[model samples]
Target: MAGTIDPDAGISAAGEPITEAEALQRLRQSEDQSQQYYAAWWLGRNRSRHPEALPLLLATLRQRRPRDPGAGVEENAIARNAARALGKLGDAGAIPELLAALDDEDDGLREAAARSLGELQATEAVAVLLRRLASGPAGAGAPRLDSPRLQEPCEAMLEALGAIGIAEPGVITLIEPFTAHDRPLIRSAACRALLQLSGEARWAEPLMQLLDHPQLQVRRAALMDLGAVGWRPALEPICHTLAENSLKLIALRGLVEQGAHHDATIQAGAVLSAMDSLL
Candidate 1:
């Protein structure tokens, strides 16, 4: 059972099917750290629903050890992987662990926790995220921030707030200012949150503009933000964007899903047609 992972094939080892038990075994008892990491990823990818999955992952979230200085990472890899896996699993039970992880000493793990919180749609985290955003490197009313001054965790908080879909004026006030943040990623993230919170084309428009941003990463961020917005009007720009077909398909699918609120059959046909022509 302790072999290589064939991700595309969805097998754990030796081309054998991996059940929930095997993956849990790897995560719980495997001596190889890499095996544990892969097990975590497989659990999340398959969305394992076994009784032990959550507790094992919660334990992994606290697994700590020093990395090889050569690895260029300082935080525990297993914990970070666990944080993300919990998000993908869509279990609200992860909320407490993830919330505490927000204050983690590791920047990367904090970002992972914030992202998972967003995936969980943890409404309880809104005010706490707002506080972190307010104190973040790109905090409101702060001087123009350079690229380094903006952190991925701040973007994660903004995206989390948006994903939770609360429309309080105070939350809007806190998030709107970042739409103009110096970093393109931050600006795109703020725009994404605004669009998700309000369903406004005004927010979607800036994200569309970012599609042509000079940097590929910025453009990719813009595409993802627009996808999260699910603004039907973005279909054209998303189709024509200079990104990979896979990303464009993802954004387009979001449009189809949102538009389906009105008419599913028609929206799917239209989106499929658009993909046929553009992708």
Candidate 2:
């Protein structure tokens, strides 16, 4: 059942050529949803094989079809797939289409668009992405309808901003407030995004503060982001974290990943101790 629901959802496109004409024809005219998905998937996957597929993939996102007529609902599975494929293609040309898709009514499509924009590191899309974060569908302050729909887009929007790597003073100002949002996930994302924007140790100070947040998830996120930024000043705090918490593996992995080897022997002992406790 899982396979049938989305056969190509997780499948990578075959890089071999199927002839540009055939792939384009199938993508534009095929009635079999799988064929359409494969066509777009392949073109994006092996964009070097057929560059023309980029535009076709963009067009597909604009065209809509019904998912369940009985339920009076339309679905753009093809478009959603196309949006993801565009990200895989890594073409800057797709940025405009993806930015427009950010406003799409379909939650899935919007999420895909956000993901692709991040993939392209589209600095131009930053303002629009910020707008979506502020007031678009499933935005920060929107009433929660479906939990995933409400939060997934917000998460993607924050992550995409991070990926864009823009540290403009204005943009940082816009994001700072979210660091204290009532929601832990948003707060977590904000901390990570800020670190991504500014790799300076000073910027990571905020995430270090979050390490003591009341919520475990928030604390974990803070630890992970601290490691991701490789902030050495937090090394002692992370090491101290191992003494009181069961998540020794997380702290050890964080220290190792960041190359904080000042206390190699101590960290090794902590790791062994943690492993022994697990056993």
Predicted structure 2, TM vs. truth:
0.63
Runs off by more than 4 Å, candidate 1: 1-17, 65-75, 140-152, 261-266
Could you estimate the TM-score for every candidate? 0.84, 0.63
- Model 1: per-residue lDDT, tens digit, 1-279? 000111222422333457778889999984787678778877987898888999999999988554455676444767877887899899899999999888776655777788888889999888778877775444532443543434445677788898888889988998887887777888888888888888776887789899999898788888777766667777778888897887777777777776655333345777778877655
Please give the lDDT score for candidate 2.
0.66
Model 2, runs deviating above 4 Å = 1-8, 11-26, 45-49, 65-74, 135-143, 182-184, 202-279
Winning model by lDDT? 1
* Residue 67 CA displacement from its true place in model 1, Å: 9.0
| Distance from true location, Cα of 250 in model 2, Å | 14
